[model samples]
Target: MPHPNQLISLLHLASPALPIGGFSYSQGLEAAIDSGFVTDAETAEVWIRDNLLHVQAHAEAPLWILLHRCWQSSDHAGVAAWNEWFHVSRETAELRLETEQMGWSLARLIAQMGWGDEGLRAALLAQSPVCLPTAFTAACVALGVDAREGLTAYCFSWLENQVAAALKTVPLGQVAGQRILYRLYPALQEAVAEAARRADSDPPMLSTFSPMLGVLSARHETQYSRLFRS
Candidate 1:
């Protein structure tokens, strides 16, 4: 059984209300909407699902697990290297800025609240522009969150945010949003499982190549009108 405190911490970390500014960014989904790639609930679900499966499953989830292990063992150098790797993996300026901004926000929040020991907290803040997964895994390690459970929470948070973005951008009804989220449950589970396998591979591999996301994000930079930043 997991500790109640750890469970609570996971919930706290995953909450959209965690003050990390996750709600303000559509992560290229808005651009996709602009391009008519995600006009209705069905298309919206497909767009979000594809990225969740292809980009996040291959990249962020497994990298998250590795970062978690690094934090668990107090490997600051390893943590820093992976953090930079994530920064470079972002294929667009908007995407890169999104992770850096969210990561910095979470790092500041955690440090202010004294979530970790002094030394660890100092090291986290030292990363300057820490990526989201690095700061998030650091929080998980500090709070005793199980690695697998943390990955689930991470992916779920992302799924919820994407669905929420779709609701606003695609202008879908509440029920439609729920339905999309409901249908993604299995894909989410598969993503978490794949992340575990990749993380445990003889030599872990991490890569994210969502070309449409890059193109859309770049176009969003000059989009005449937009709701979300990215």
Candidate 2:
């Protein structure tokens, strides 16, 4: 078990204020809003929650844990192999762009911050190869966060970014956004706990059946009416 400060470390890595530039990418929430899948406040709630559970929680959170393990073992080569899986397995262009760009940004930030940690640096060694969650969890490890805490924070940050974007693009009222977050709290908690429990297992796996969302994100690249970078 980790010390209490481990939780603080995780929180720092997943903060909305983190230099990873996560706020700049809506993860296609903008496209979903355009397509009416996220027209209203309630729908926004569903979209964020569903996307987290089906996509980020399942698909990326496990990888965050895996990357954390890799960092712990100082296995930069293994980290690269996993990043290869992350890059090619991304189903669409926007998804690929989101991960790739954020990964590079995080790598750059690590250099500027002079984190001075070889393991963290190794995990994101390649420019275009590292995944977002991998980079995120790397910061957590550098700060002494536990692997499970890192995974939960990684998953939660996805939901936070979506809901925050919806507040701006949909112009959802503050009360409405808070309500949606509250409604998602239970599921979010369960997913986080589940992620923590499974952190040490064989590559963490989550569902990835959001092809329509993927299509919207890809379409967003050329979208003449974009409110978010995607």
Candidate 3:
């Protein structure tokens, strides 16, 4: 069991109000809508759920676990290597920029809040444009959050932001958005579990295999009258 304070810290980090600008980017969902892949609440739920299971579960979540371990052990080299890998893994320009901006924002916030030691903060800032999972994992390690709990929080934050984007762009009603989120609770758990298992592999193998999301995100860069950034 985690200490109450640690759990609280996880909640705070996961909060939608963290000011990392997570709400600004829709992570290609907007393009999905623009392209008619996601229109109503049902399609919206399916879109988000599929990405959550496929992309985040196989790649970002396991990457988060690896980054958490590296941060915990103070392996600056490993951290930088994985950070660069994640940056390269972003399939589109907007997607890449989203992580860079959000990660940069969170890195600065971590420094301002004094969450980690001088060395850890220095190492984190060393990455020219740290990816979100790298920066987020650093905070979790500094704050004493368990790896599993930290990844869970990360996924929840992503899910909440996706659902919020659906509400605005898909124009779903509040109740409908809630229903979408409510239905994906189990999928979220399964995603985290799969991420853990993947991370535990002898040498973790991460996938960036969501081609449709890549295409849609690229399309979003030129999307007309877009509501979200990506």
Candidate 4:
């Protein structure tokens, strides 16, 4: 069991309502819907599940875990290297911008909260564009959240945001959205477990191979009228 304070901190960090501007991004879901790729609740569920398992679990989550370890060990150089790698891994401009913008927001939030060592915070903020996972990991370390718990919360927060985006884009009923989230519970658990295991291996394997999502995000960049930033 986690300490009560740590659990509360995780909840706060993972909350969708946490003023991080996460609500504005569908992460290509909107574009996918407009393109008829995610036409209904079932399809929306499939799209989100595929992303959770393939893109996020294989790529982003492992990085998030590594960032957590880096922050915990005061590995500032490792944090910056991972952040740059994450920036480069983005397949499209919009996708890159999304992470950068969210990273800046989260980093500012952490600074405002007065967490972490000042020197570490300054070093992170000095990065040209802080990525979300790195900023989130730094904040978790500062707040004394366990790396596993932080990673779990990070994944869950992403799951919640994707589901929320689907609710609007897929126009699914609230109950249906809840059902989809419930069905994804196992996948979420598996992703967290895989991320933890991968964090232990040297030269972590990071994948960025979602061709369709990349295309959609690229298309979304010039979408005539859009509800999401990407």
Candidate 5:
């Protein structure tokens, strides 16, 4: 059982207010929006859900777990070691940036908190090429938050950002964005369960098998008139 302070830490780690500069990146929503594949609210919901489940869940989430385990074992070098797989596994440049930038920002923010700075800074300074989940998991642990709570919030926040991106780029209504978020709750829960299961697994196998989505991520890099990064 977790302590009261532990639970409070979990809440803070999971809260949407925790700044990792997530609102700036779209995770490929801009390209999907321009491509007509995600123009409407209904279509936008499907696209976001697909991304959360297929891409982030398998590819990025495992990195979080590995980073958490690395912290637990005090393998500062191991964090840097994981970057190779992050690059090779993720098929596109923009996708890589989205994760790394978010991870880096999260690391920087966590560093200023005056807690868990030693291991976290060492891991980041080693050029870990961290992803959002990687920074998120590390910060959560440093803050005394449990992994499950950390992951739960991470999953929800991912969805929230995508929905915001969709609302702006895809032109989905405010109400529609809420609907999309409401619909994704169950999927997030399922992802949390999956994350828990893979906590010990070594970077589980994953790829964005959604061909159209991958193309959009690639195309977003050159979208001459775009509002968000992939």
Candidate 6:
């Protein structure tokens, strides 16, 4: 079993109500549904799983691990570089805004909790945009969470938010959402492993090429009717 403090910190960081405004963005899931790509619970599960494997596992999860280590090692330049890379990799204006906005919100939350180091806080305040993964990694480090546990919590937090988005947009029942999350367990584990391996190497190149998702997100910017931010 994990240390009690670490487990509690993970739970706190992974909470859906973390006040980072994560609930507002579906990360293009709404657009996917609008285009008839993800309508039902099963389709939702498949869409999320594919993203988890192809996009997130390859990109953001690895970055999250890298940022976690940067925070641990006091590598401020690495943190800033990775944060900017993530911001630029966002395909659409809305996607970029979503990350920047959420990043700022999480940074503020850290400030409010008084868990932030002065240097990190100053860096975040000075920066025009801080990506969510960087802020979250900094938060985990401040809270004294280990990298493996922090990365797990980070992925799970994302999973929970996506599941909630599916429940609201796909109009899935609560039980169906729970079932989808349950089904994603294996993929989530694989993602954590992949991220760990990537983090062990020299910082890997960032890749955020999801053509279909890019199309959907771009279309979502002009969507006739929408329930999510992106």
Best prediction by lDDT? 3
- Which is superior by lDDT, 1 or 4? 1
Q: What's the lDDT for residue 52 in model 3? A: 96
Check candidate 6 and list the clashing pairs.
none
lDDT per residue for candidate 1 within 108-129, as digits (tens), equals 9989888878877987998968
- Show how many residue pairs clash in every candidate, following the order shown: 0, 1, 0, 0, 0, 0
Ranking by TM-score: 3, 1, 4, 6, 2, 5
Candidate 6's residue-wise lDDT over 1-230, tens digit each? 54468888888889987889999999999999999999899999999999988888888998998888888888888888888888989999999999899999988888888885888777666656888998999998888888888888888888888999999988899999999999999999998888777667764744787999899999999999999999
Per-residue CA lDDT of candidate 2, range 1-230, in tens?
Answer: 67668767666767888776788888888888777778899788888887766666665666667777877777777677777777887877878878877887777777677663765674466546667766765667666777766666777777778888999998798899888877887878777665555555554554566787779888889888876778
Alpha-carbon local distance difference test for all models: 0.91, 0.74, 0.93, 0.88, 0.73, 0.87
Instruction: Using TM-score, give the best candidate's number.
Output: 3
Residue 143 deviation, candidate 2, in Å?
Answer: 1.2
For model 5, the stretches where C-alpha displacement exceeds 4 angstroms are 14-16, 198-203, 208-210
**In lDDT terms, how accurate is model 2?**
0.74
Question: Residue 39's C-alpha lDDT in candidate 6?
Answer: 89
lDDT of 4 at 120: 73
Q: Per-residue lDDT of 1-230 in model 5, one digit per residue for the tens?
A: 66458767766765667776677778678887777777788888888887777766765665666767777676767766665566556668987887788778777787777667585666765665766666776777677676666677777777888888887877878998998899889988777666556555554544446677677778988889987767
Native-to-model Cα distance after best TM-score fit, residue 132 in candidate 2, in Å: 1.3
Candidate 2 segments whose C-alpha is farther than 4 A from its true place: 1-4, 194-207
Which 10 consecutive positions of candidate 2 have the poorest summed lDDT?
A: 198-207
| Deviation of model 5 at 129, angstroms | 3.3
lDDT head-to-head 5 vs 6, winner: 6
Q: What's the true lDDT of residue 145 in model 2?
A: 75
Query: TM-score of model 2 relative to the true fold?
Result: 0.88
- Residue 15 miss distance in model 4 (angstroms): 0.8
Candidate 3 per-residue C-alpha lDDT over 45-149 given as tens digits, one digit per residue, 9 for 90 to 100: 999999999999999999999999999999999999999999999988998999999999999999999997999999999998989999999999888898999
